[model samples]
Target: MKKLPVNCPSCEKSLVVSQLSCSNCETVISGSYSLPILLQLSSEDQDFIFEFILSSGSLKKIAIKLGKSYPTVRNKLDDIIERISQLQKS
Candidate 1:
């Protein structure tokens, strides 16, 4: 499935979840709900996090899985951490 956008394309502004639906029941609900800061990250970052979870947050495993060096993976993780910190404060 394609990821839903978390930001406006033209304005590059954060977006809120205004509507939700149930695929099973076709029930629709509408309201303004802020997305978690994590969801606001880029899809690549989100995927990295998913992989991190799959690896049980093991940086070594993540590095090996991605065919990257441990330092590279660690730097990626540091960047993710910085982004999360900034997002949480906003």
Candidate 2:
């Protein structure tokens, strides 16, 4: 089985899913199926978000684990939070 391509090659644009098909039955359902808002984020932001969650929202721990400055980790977390909030609103 081939994995579905999640990003556009030409422009590197994010691809949103519009439908899901059942391979066995050949049944298709189509509607507004948006990708989880987090999927739209950059890889770095996603990693930061994952670490933030795994670290139980501790900035100090996240900074140490990521080998980054506390301020840098905090800034990335803030950015991801803002993006998540925006996605929720939209």
Candidate 3:
């Protein structure tokens, strides 16, 4: 399945979840709703986070898994941390 976008492509604005449906019941609900902070991140950031979790939050393991240098992995992690912090602050 294709990933759902968390932001608008044109305006580069965050998108709201306005409607939801249950495939099993065909029940639909509509309302203005906000996404969690993590879900608001770009897809690349989300993949990095998923890998970090799969690596048990170890930079060394992440570096090895991604075949990147340790410093590079660390830097990426640092950037992700700052981005997440900024997102949460808003």
Every candidate's lDDT: 0.94, 0.81, 0.90
In candidate 2, stretches whose alpha carbon ends up further than 4 angstroms from where it belongs are: 1-14, 22-28, 88-90
What candidate 3 gets wrong by more than 4 Å, as runs, is none
Q: Find the candidate with the highest lDDT and give its number.
A: 1
On the 0 to 100 scale, the lDDT of residue 38 in model 3 is: 88
Quote the positional error of residue 41 for candidate 1 in Å: 1.0
- Comparing 1 and 3 on lDDT, the stronger one: 1
Model 1 CA deviation exceeding 4 Å by range? none
Candidate 2 residues 7-69, lDDT tens each? 788897668888899999999999867677777776768777788789998999988998989
What are the C-alpha RMSDs, in order, of all predicted structures? 1.2, 3.8, 1.2
Candidate that beats the other on TM-score, 1 or 3, i.e. the better one = 1
